[model samples]
Target chain A: MSYSSQAIAKPYFTVAITLFAVQVLFGLIIGMQYVAINIEGIMFDTARLIHTNLLIIWLLFGFMGASYYIVPEEAEQELYNPKLAIQSLWLFLALTIITVLGYLLLPYATFAKITGNQFFPTMGREYLEQPTIIKLGIFAVLCAFTYNISMTILHGRKTIINLLLLTGIAGSTIVFIFAFYNSSNLVVAKYYRWWLIHFWFEGTWELIMEAILAYIIFKVTGNREIVEKWLYIIVAVTLTTVILGIGHHYYWIGVPEYWQWIGTLFSVFELLPFFFMLLFVFNVVNCTKCHSSNKALKLWALSTPIMAFLGAGVLGFLHTLAPINYYSHGTQITSAHGHLAFYSTYVMIVLAIISYTMPILQNNINNRIVQKLEILAFWLMTVSMSFMVLFIAVAGIMQVYIQRATDLALPFIEIQNSMMILYWLRGAGGLVFFIGVIIYIIGFFYNRHLAVD
Target chain B: MKILTKPKYIYYSSLIIFICLLLGLTIHTIIVLPERDHRDNLTPQIIQGKMVWEENNCIGCHTLLGEGAYFAPELGNIYKRRGGSHGGAYFIKAWLKAMPTNIPGRRQMPQFNLTDEELHALIAFLKWTSEINTSSWPPSEKG
Candidate 1:
């Protein structure tokens, strides 16, 4: 009942840590599958969908936990109810379990029945075979999360940042609902599906980025005024960017002709919030005169916002233009952007929160060592993931060039087969990133006994 | 005493720079948009072909003048892209008439069963699209 240091943060920490590990591990398997012919007797085609989907689910869970921990702090009140929070968590957990089980059980059989004309082992089926029910389950879970977060925010104090956060969550809810209707009709459904995916990427996720960056800035600098200013800038810029930035996804789809111009124009502006975020965080860190904290911790906290901005913002800019994206859409190049921008901004923010809170819970060890290790892990993983994305993008570009050069149609399989070198380089990058994840995981648990008072 | 740590000027300056960049980019795009080009001689065949294309949803599967779904290749310059007019009206007519050809592992294009007259009209529609001044999309003849 007390809002003191005795509050149990261990469970949240445990969930975050476990999800991070699972994400990194699956990420590595997906990476290796790119290069290796037969890893665990599964095709790369089937493995990748699972890998990306799993990464998205786990990361979303981590983000939810981070938000749950922070909203109460910002409000200067205990969570509206810990029981409700736990209830939300259980619903998400149940839904995820059911979905995964269905994916493993029903999907393979369906794939075999449809394509292979026979039954096969359940665990070995292609990912696309999963029933539409799994998608429905995911939508339900998203609704539950939206309701919990909305109710919590309603009862708690409302700041600009929290309100923006609520908006992002609300947008996510709408997008999820839209996603459920995606298979009803191909023409309208395809447009709406892009609305969910593209809007989530270019719109609501932009707001989510702002909220995370604001929280990180507040924790690190203790300058609420500065944080608030940047938050406004981020939200304003992101809204403008996403509303039109959606044109980027529209280019390939059978959308209206004018969307190409609109998407390209807005995407260019999307870089603005990112640039502001970088300037804001670095300026804050530079102005700080205190050295009482670990240099490693300080650096990690200082760098998270900036990196998120770069990963999602600058790298995202590389192929978003209509001219370049016309060639690169649905290729490995787009995948590269998603890998870096999504992981860097969202994943780092979650970890940054974990780094901040676990210490407050128990400061029995030196902060510097943990901070240093965390920073080290951050760079190691980020660089590797960046390499994986870039290599694949280049390969994709090369494939497109070669493919279009021939008047005769080339097989998609042949294109994939020829890009073995790029795949290996990508796999190598994943391995390096996994190594970093292991380092971070070790540092996380070790800090339990090792924080300084 | 307190140390004068806050740089009010720098924050304001940073804000100014961001605003300038936005205005600059928007203006640049407007300036770079290609001037609209018009074609003379409104032929009946071309008009009829365009009607055929629209009614059959050719734009759903193919891009022409960079103004359609990209599910298929850009046919805006297909006359030159195929290294001959071989892929023009006659070739397109045949292709649409017997699409999907039972080719395994290839995306099947739908057969519209357009009459010879309609096929010729659709071909004329595509040829007309190819003739439009698009300032060179796909960046190559083969595209």
Candidate 2:
């Protein structure tokens, strides 16, 4: 909130939390559908489309907001073209709303026809299902965002954190351009799709997270040099592991068989950064005199790396081996990994940044009640998501055993039927997670009137 | 004592080594491993079938190449299972036409009302996909 440009992030963060709540709602719908509740007209597939797309969009918003907030502060300058920033935000939000409504209201095929998907035909590719027009819109918005942030950095001081963040944003934008390159060859299409997905999450986004975590560590501990050095090491390790780790997705795709060995070897080391992140956070926190009064922010920063390691690192490792992934691929195990990895790595980090910055925007003098609510929300969400992951993992294991492992292989439907209890448990977990998100939103708005008064 | 006190060189060298290793791996994956013959031999019908699959959002329910929703069985190997020794392209074509068996209490696939041409193309695409080297996936034909 130091510069007027930083205020642009407030709306973005608000929108992010709002979409997050919507995502959880859709997640609950899908969860219910998992347990045999059939809502008329709204298929589980449709709910899934909404849920996954919203998750990606909301996280993009979070990342954009975080960049807007962090870049100005780290670079020690006002944003370049705050007006353009706000305009792009609105356009992005509008497009998201329109796209989501289309997904909900129209049948998938009908929606595809109306969206002019026949021209480019990039629908139904997991997570890249946005119409060509919408994809173009996203590209346009990201280019504008990159320009704004790049200009700000160029005009001001350049630090390791700012440089790393810019690299991430730029790298992701460049990789995303390939989303338009949908080839007829399924192998080629799947190969390039991972260029966006794996490169974003495991590759560039990790750099962004590292930069943000470093910024937070510096803010809290006032140890710039130590944070920078650690960030360098972390980035080095990340580059070493993640670039080759893209092979993990290649193992089951129509790629060559050599990917089995390459994928396993590299993906095994993908856990190092998360593990390093956990260590880095704890080391910084332990050494610091605790400058920030926001204990909730500290809690978030601490938990992010820990949960990231457990979710993205441990759970990811459990199935990353090509042999095990052979059985677990496309099962509930994948869902379990996805849930924990995204929540721990992306969701938690975004909330951590929001937790740190929101109070500054509001100029809250006393945030005791808000802090307590946030902590409660944090624990509730973390515990519930963990339970969700556990339930899904058990279900996935059962599926692997019953459907894939034994000589008496059961059909997919029979296994799914036997896993109804786990789905119900997962649905209950989703309910708790939604409640936690509601509490988080409440915490954001709490005492705002008092602050204004 | 000086080396221990200032490890900047070590850090920089490690980073350089890591980047080189990454570049090496990327080149290997991009240039070496992908099967050129299969990619080159993809037919127009198979390409159209892939487009049809994308347009219809089939991956929304079915897993293909171990990607996509797990609600339905994996279709990456469906051609092998349905059109291999025991079955043929006719079986797959019939299966698509007869979807949504509505077998009470089972997950049902929506009938997309695909044209005969579209069905033929889709079967061709699945057959093409089945021939690609998936590094031994699905664990069994049960996929």
Candidate 3:
């Protein structure tokens, strides 16, 4: 039961938080750019690259940090070498910074300045589409973390949590393996990229999410039996989704027509785990009966899984039906699905871990009022972000009906102009969410002051 | 005495049921699939036309049969919709070759600088697409 302040895991968590903060800033910029297209186009491209790439880096860092923190405890042995873990963290941070800088400088490069001649013709014009180098960097980082963590797990302890962790690691490995493939054929490369993208989301992240939910339940209630049962259910549901749910991504890809039916059907059932996550989070937290005491933890515990359902499960289901998605696949509705679901599963995991650690770092902060305020900030941020997504999704549906279904020969400018109100709403929602972030950061430092180690 | 819970065959049966559902779906798709014509059955002229269409990623801009990005008009019903003896193959070919030269503010379709052979092939592909039975899709004579 000994806890050390000098743990190497600390720096990983620090880097993760720093990356997340940068991600949030880029997210805000992206949200704002949608509101006004005239606002410096440079900002627009920068935000897009940062917002997307930061999601990859921050989630990877957070998951790695969480693993470093928990792996030793589950294994009943200290980390294989704390020094190696620290070195991996530094290597990852350096690689991510270099990659982000490269992406930002892309617009200014001589290649970009060239006209008629394709800039980075080998890779597409879009920075996001410049997947080769970015994917390679990410794959290296994933391998480093996976190897170190796998070695730790093998030499140390075995727990149900370890099994879940191993599954996620395996999934990450598969995702990286797909990154190396560059067929001479252009059509084949695009097809394989989706395997890495969609599979990582529906497959690997599912395992990580299940493990986190189980970990939270166990930690909050000190109930092993319940956690074990829930883990079994989560694992079963995740596997079901992973194997079949990839069809959802295949619909628009010229893969095969049959995948549409398979994707829609399996994705419909994919909502089951999310439903269970919702019930499991709330029901378990409620069962604890810790009346308003540990309110922040309770809210943190409840919201992570609940948002997963509301955002990923319910909202995801709305447009995922093949009939509905046939029109909305590449539209803003898909963006809404991505923003909310990624925020829920990945962002909320990081938030949950932060919530868990905050109290531990500051054991003296028994003030229920402050915890409640933090909880309120959590709700404010979560609700505003989710509402932003919902508004955009509605805007997307409108765009689809007007622009796609009907033949108005309506100009894209007119449609874009019409969608400004939704963008404004999204910006307002982002402002409220940002305000919550400010409050939470303030609370974090205040709590830190009281529990300065 | 600890009571041993019997293994529920029903649990396993549900897995079997799930598999059956997927299998049934697969079978339904195969059975209902339209018999596809061979690439050779398509005239070499038409095949070449399709290759031209693909090389320029025309489908990336204009959808046929409700596929591809909707950045441009649905070319699926273009022949019938544009209507007139003038809207025949010759006119279509001329319009594509000299696209955006006439219409202002129109998204200028990039000139691919195709040879006459390539141009004829593209027209063949467009004609082939126009002939597909779309069951009154586009929903207008002038889409």
Best by DockQ: 2
Best-performing candidate as measured by lDDT: 2
Of the candidates numbered 1 and 3, which has the greater TM-score value? 3
In model 1, what lDDT does residue A395 have? 79
Instruction: Summarize candidate 1's per-residue lDDT along A68-141 as a digit string, tens digits.
Output: 66666666666665665566566666755564444344433343334332221111211222334555656676
User: Model 1 chain A: which ten-residue window has the lowest total lDDT?
Assistant: A118-127
Q: For the second chain of model 1, what is the TM-score against the true structure's chain B?
A: 0.66
Which residue pairs come into collision in candidate 1? A247-A263, A363-A452, A364-A451, A364-A452, A365-A450, A365-A451, A365-A452, B49-B121
DockQ of 2: 0.54
* TM-score, prediction 2: 0.95
DockQ for every model comes to 0.05, 0.54, 0.08
Error of 1 at A318 (Å): 2.9
- Give a tens-digit lDDT track for model 2, residues A305-414: 99999999999987899888988999989999999999998999999999888888778843898999899999999999999999999999999999889998987877
For candidate 3, write residues A1-453 as lDDT tens digits: 233522555566667767777777777876776665334434354556576777877787777777776777777777776776777777888877865665565442222223211312223311223344455556666776777778778997777787688778767776766655543222234445556776677767778867866776677788766676666666667666656676676564334566778889988988998988877776776777443346676667777787888788888887777777777765667678888999888888777766665566456544565576688788888899989988888887777777667767453435766777888898888888878877776666566667656
Winner by TM-score: 2
All candidates: interface RMSD: 12.4, 2.6, 8.0
Clashing pairs in model 2, backbone N/Cα/C closer than 3 A: none
